[model samples]
Target: MALPVGIFALFVLMVLPIPPLLLDIFFVLNIAISVAVLMVALNARQPLDFSSFPSVLLFATLLRLALNVASTRIVLVNGHEGGNAAGEIIESFGQFLVGGNFAVGLFVFCILLIINMIVITKGAGRVSEVSARFVLDALPGKQMAIDADIAAGLITADEARTRRREVTIEADFYGSMDGASKFVKGDAIAALLILGVNIIAGFALGMISHGLSAGEAGELYITLAVGDALVAQVPALLLSIAAAAIVTRVADARDLSGQIGGQFADPRGWLPVALILAAIGMVPAMPQLIFFPAAAIAGALWWTLRQRAARPAPVEQPVEEVSPDRIDIADVSDQTLVTVELGYGLVHLVDKDKGAPLLTRITGIRKQLSRDLGFVLPQFRIRDSLDVGANEYRVLLGGLAIAHGTAKPSRLLAIDTGEVRPGHGLTGEATRDPSFDCPALWIDPAARDHAVSEGFLTVDPSTVIATHANQELLRNSDQLLGPEEVRALVDDLKERAPALIEAIHPDPLGLAALTRIFRALIADGIALAHPQPLLTSLALALQKTQDFDSVIDAVRADMGARLIARICEPGERLKVVTLDAALEGAILGGMVDPGTGQPLIEPDCGSMIAERVNRHIDEAKGPVALIVQPPARRALAALLRQRASRCLVLSINELPARQPVEVVGVIGADNPAHQLPAPTEEVQAA
Candidate 1:
């Protein structure tokens, strides 16, 4: 739409008596580019990830605006404005404001654009809006604001309105460059019309009184100017403002949270546009001044008023050098002894964009960070801080660790401290690392424990964590222990519970089971980290216990009878025709077994399992390491989706069903924790 108007403006300028300028060409280019952009945006199928758009637009706008300034400055400062220095810049810009044939054509086009925009606005308003997702740590982070509303359970529902909208008001930096306040669409149109009417009317009056006195000619120009101001500028001003107001109101409604102070602002722009448009429409001949100040001033005033209304009340600042009531750092977050151990090497922190991912143990808990990120350790109360260059910043979490690396041209994002959940053994790991340069954050001691349950981080012992109970010792365990010792250990476990420990045949059984279970919960998009350890421990205890028969029954009980029944079912099938029909969305009457018609596994208990299972299913995430082929896989998947206490359905295939849960810790079957592989095939044959 903007392009069509621009093209018509270009076509009109080509034939117009007045000379065209570079500014007019720039406007043409902008309209052309905007049209192309709109087409592309409409076709993108995926959710628009607008994370980088704002910054990119800001850079582009700034650069182009600078270009505009330089162009205008060079032209005006050198006294090269076709007219003169005082009004040449204005005249140059005024050419782009186009009236007469250009104005009429643009006016028709803008009307169409407005109508189409209204349709889009109304239709889009009816569609459901998707909420933005944020990145969080897998393990819980220390709380920042103990929001008052959270304490009152207000955040759970609608108490806290969604504040996810982002708004950017593109200010025309060319205002200062043009030696005028600003220019908007209305201003450009108004200016064009002003030029058109003045030129046409002035020519007509001059011809009409060919033999008249100079005073008569001057009177004609004055009459044209006054008549335009009263009959046209006044009404046109009101109309332009009304249009802007309507557009702004609709915009505000559509983006309640995004109406920033400067959004939909800059009436100076509209004023210019309005003046140009009005000037073009009146009496064909223009006046001498041609509404020189009218449009720009009016638009500027309107913009100022809009922005002024939204400015926030100023915050009262403390004037005294020493704040008498200022509290100590310890007042908000008492220092803790325990610290989280982030295990990434110094290299990781240096190349943090890639390294940050590699260094953190982000489960789908607080943040659903990928597994490869490793254990992102946190500083104690006095660890790292933004105190990078501060005169002094007393350590908050343990001490700081600033691993040295060559600086980049610019450091976009840097996290100096881990969110420390206060009580969970922070002080124990609060050792110092002066090598690191980042902020150290601390939490209230009591706060950490209350925030996290044990199961959240209770990962399998096989998977190598950044900082586990033992680091160096575990690394050398393989080298120190002979093959015979390892064999003996395996032999002993097999002998003790031959049935349960039938074999430790290398497989992703443990890892797949664990990952699968959690993955399902994670997809549920709900919180469910609490039962991981409980389930893992149960799997281990069952594997180790001597009383296999009794424990299997207990396992069934712990798993809930329905899950057992499902797993014990005969075949694989995709039961849920849709996600809504899955156990997550199951209700009593809708899905009762046909024969018994009994609420498929009693309604009350089903609800409880659904809640618990949903939570776990949402958390377990990873690869399909252990493939369970055929009926077995199908049965397991069915059980997990429909009846499990807390489980996810990884592909149920040839993978062994009785594998211990510890496998989850292992990345794959060829784990460092597992026994060495068998000898070559030739050697086995011999």
Candidate 2:
């Protein structure tokens, strides 16, 4: 509203006659405003700090032009009376400042106009144009760098958004200045035209209307004309200089004077300049007085700067003392459920614009594992780490580094798929696979086709990190489940099977107990994808006993088919790698009690069984189940849990009736496969 009203007043200024007092006030206001603008331009540290400068320039230009029109009106109508007909401001410039000579006032006005139009305004426009063009050109690259920093975890999402906004403002400021510079150029041109019109028209009105002699009319009218032009042109010149200062100023953290002073404060840079000036002073044709004084001043400045540099900088005093109570434990919580920390070189693996597959692969892993495990997989927090090698990445579980490996961002990883042609022999740069620790090689992307032909599995750096992260999530699925996840399961169950959930032991089998049971199941490699039987088994098991081990045993018994499905494919005979009858008997004998369900195996016996089972696992072609008796199954699974990650201990009752069994290998026995039963009808059908 104020801007429109001001513009309306500017138009009214041409028609209305201003008293000399008011005209003088407006003239002073114009000069003061121009000085204020110049001061602001000099103090601005960056272009964005004065983003409103371009619009201010446009308004100031219009105000000066409007004032010129009003003063022209007054001069033409009343010039024959005296110099004061226009205003005291114009009269002072005409008579006193110009020594009552119209010619001197004209000369000063033209000189100001030439400086503004030809030098300052023109140069400022070109600078604004180039700055705007360059800023626009660099905008996309700046945006990409911000996004990369966000992905690399060097900055948070909020910081990235702020930087993007700054980039936009910088581009907009320069673009506005590019167009606004035209206002200064036009103002300079208009000042020249206004001066000419004021002189010619004022002379005509003085002679025809007031009937003055030619010499008298010329003297009186020309004096006021030059005065009005000078008053308006002075403000115009100040504004042009202000515009030039704004456009030419480079961005720094300090104001113009501070920047210049700091840059030249060093004696090293100015010593050579001082020497040059001193040498020039000694030349024959050079003015000795001017050049010698300048050299001495330069030398003095250099000496003073050197003294300042030799002095030690004062230490800064702390404003506030740090207290022990101010230490926040939350700052070091360190309870990250899952995270992937990338080294700087692997930072590109998380960049979405680069089509990095790590984040997408992690999402897919969460989705697939959630369905397979019957519990939501926790989100993995991806970040960057400077502590590791540039090509390395680490997978963390529960804030502990669980696995780490290196990848080549510009190369492909080709795993020895175990089916390579003879003599091919893993030909590329050998490395261990991050996901499974399988022997693999990093090969150039150009060699990917050849690697694939040689039966190697080729993957990129992103896929390598992602696969490793996914495997870790699955392997540590039990540790990842929390009370919050358990509550989510209960809430979901209540929606579909309210009464079934309600029937469970509310006193002994709450969310915590259920979460423990699920953790135990997942720890033993049980998939909870079908929750109905597990819930039903838990409801029944809790009715019999509140003991956790017994209840977990019953749940495992009830999930027998689901567990078997994990080890055996559809319609395939289940391969058995069992223990010798004697070893099984010893394990059963080692049990402290069947009811208490304690395993008291001797150390030597326990070590021997673990070694045998691990050996069998190493020899197996694919997944194989270890069939044990019902009483010893829980204790034996617990015993092998630490040593053999792949081995599954199953009780005979847990086996599906229709599935046929083949004894492929046995722990603690020789020729175990030779002891296999001849094909029964069920085995033949399978």
lDDT, each prediction: 0.32, 0.81
Which candidate leads in lDDT? 2
The true-versus-predicted C-alpha distance at residue 145 of model 2, in Å, is 2.5
Q: What lDDT tens digits, residue by residue, belong to model 2 across residues 1-686?
A: 98899888888876788777877888898899899999998899977888899899988988888888888877887787887888899999999989989999888888888888888888989999999999999998787676555544457657978999999998998999999988888887887888788777777777788888888988988998888888888888888887888889888999988999899788998778788998998999999898888888888888999999999999899779768678677777864577788899988777766755676666567668889888776555788899789998998888788878888989999997687777774467888887777778889998888988888899988888878777877777798888888888878888899888888735567778778888988887776677777788888888898888778878777778788887787777777877789887877776485566575677787788788777766676676788988877877777877667677789887876666777777777775474444457866577
Which candidate number has the best TM-score? 2
**lDDT (0-100) at residue 501 of candidate 1?**
32
Candidate 1 per-residue C-alpha lDDT over 147-255 given as tens digits, one digit per residue, 9 for 90 to 100: 2222222242233222112111111111111211122233335434553554355445454645434454333332332222222222223322322222223222233
Model 1 C-alpha RMSD to native: 24.4
Candidate 2 Cα errors over 4 Å, as ranges: 1-5, 267-306, 315-338, 342-392, 400-408, 412-460, 463-686
Tell me the spans in candidate 1 whose CA falls farther than 4 Å from its real position: 1-153, 156-161, 166-181, 184-212, 236-365, 368-686
- In candidate 2, residue 585 scores what lDDT? 84
